[model samples]
Target chain A: MTAVRVIAALALFIPHAALAGEPIGQIKTQTGTVFVERAGASKPVAIGDRVFESDTIVTTSGTVGITFTDNSMMSLGPMSRLKLDQFKFDATTHNGVFNSSLQKGTLSVKSGNIVRQTPEAMHIRTPAALLGVRGTEFVVRADDAS
Target chain B: MTRLRLIAPLASALALSACCGPKDLIVVLPGADGHVGGVIVETGGSKLVLDKAYAGARPGSGASEPVDVSAYEVERVFAKALAARPIPPKTYTLYFVSGGDEIVPESRAELDAMLAEIGDRKAVEVVVTGHTDTMGSSSDNDRLSLERARSVEAQLKDTLAAKGVQSDSVTAVGRGERELLVKTADQTADPRNRRVEITVR
Candidate 1:
């Protein structure tokens, strides 16, 4: 635990440039195994790890939760591959766009300020169809059997 | 008569299923300042616009019809997101007295409000940027601005700690006269420019 704390402290000091991209959110919770693929390189996702746009998150045997800058939350269940396709928000105006694609498995989303400011700003895509959120919570699950 | 009885039961079952509804994607919004405007759910080239509470299925999905969810259900589905949600970044401006780090009396209320808002959050990130009017030498303004930012940061940190709020990060920077809130000629004393801007997230 001490070592983890040390790493978390050090992480705060790491220049943003070292992270190699614009951070859209951070991993909030992880149970079991989770990996993120960015720039063609895959790495294990830690609790405080930053997630950037275009990053693909795959959970092999557990669940992972991520919170975006807009305070939106996305949780992925086991055997899920979720992509942060696009995220853009204006801090001042609190208006932005949220778009993601769920390749497989179960995922849940809670809308944030971006949707609050304009309800039509969010879009989620699955192999079966595209989803547009109106201002409430919901869940989706996709499997090959369906 | 036997066939009619069987069809009646089947019809009732279908009605019950419709009432239960199909599971649609949920998008929970904030309930602080009243209901958010609404959301649009689109599928298979068709769109369903939900402006009130909840939307169950996409239009033309042939599954369940879209309907409004109660405020109670909205809160329930959004519980997790609400708990993990971060306080949005907000900027508070406090004007300074003439040439010193001391804030103007009128700005104290703004400072207090900012502190109160910060106290409500469990975790926060603060950025205090100090600015100066185009008065005196650039070097002097630079130092004074930084001093002002430090002052605000110190007070903010103390208040937040008292409220059991953890400050993830606190940054103070002095913009000097480079970025003026109001455009002014050199040596012009503008109270609006001589201010500290505190942003809390």
Candidate 2:
């Protein structure tokens, strides 16, 4: 943990911020922990952290809420599992694509214009079904088979 | 008369099954308790929901209020995804470095497994968010939170890409230290406050 912290701090010093178009500032959790990870690595998410596809973060308890770059909001409730598979946006074309899957637990989602523009571009999956959104907020939960 | 009696039972059974279709199932809501459970039944074009009111009462959080889960909440649980049957919600708590975006190394294996579970599903929407403890200035906290969220977002996109999942399906955001699990605002820095949250939609 300590080692990762050192690296994360170092990252802020580098000019990578220009490359990633990263958030305006430091990313944190409801618990007040700062965010850190290798530039191309996924950070593990905890309660209060907004989730994203590139990080591939997971939780062990409770729920987390997320607001995407396009202003879409999603919430994940306890024990639920999900992954941000892919997301790409072209501001000029107004084309933003996002996809993910929920393995277990529950999630509530509110889609925005980006998702509405490319309806097929938004996707969420559960243990028994796959959700394709056309701009709406929805929830899903699945039990752990194990 | 004999034919009607036999047909009546069959008709009723069919009707019941119809009401129990996959789209009609209701999900269990998170309770104050540690565990939460819910049930879903299909009714016409809508859904029938059954949930344990106080089933999620956590042991030490003061008194366990009667579980007041709303039918709408139950609906939200199932409404997040599209499926034919009830999908139970799973929970995970993440531990992060203080003032940083790194995850505990030991948690990787579990995280990897969960990632795979979601990655294999082509239609899922992944959400990643970051939060902060009450220890720092709100301005700094917000910056830290977003940085953390972006870091996770990068990681998820990279990992999934390696695993053959497309990278364009994920979304990431930062929420700063606005919400806390333990509620330790004015006094000290709570370790539990340092964390991030992930969800599926």
Candidate maximizing lDDT: 1
Query: After TM-score superposition, what is the CA distance of residue B16 in candidate 1 from its true location, in Å?
Result: 18
For candidate 2, lDDT tens digit of each residue in A27-111? 1122222232335764554432334344443444444555565546555555556666676764323377777766666666556
- Candidate 1: residue A123 Cα off by (Å): 2.3
TM-score (2 decimals) of chain A in model 1: 0.84
TM-score of each: 0.54, 0.36
Chain A only: TM-score of every candidate?
A: 0.84, 0.64
DockQ-derived CAPRI band for the predicted complex in model 1 = incorrect
DockQ of each: 0.18, 0.04
Q: List the lowest-lDDT window of 10 residues for candidate 2 chain A.
A: A24-33
**Model 1 CA lDDT for position B109:** 92
Error of 2 at B190 (Å): 2.0
Off by over 4 Å in 1: A1-19, A60-63, A71-80, A90-96, A105-119, A132-146, B1-24, B27-32, B58-64, B68-124, B127-201
lDDT of 1 at B57: 46
Summarize candidate 2's per-residue lDDT along B34-122 as a digit string, tens digits. 33233332222333333453122111123223234466656545443332221222324566755456778755765766676665443
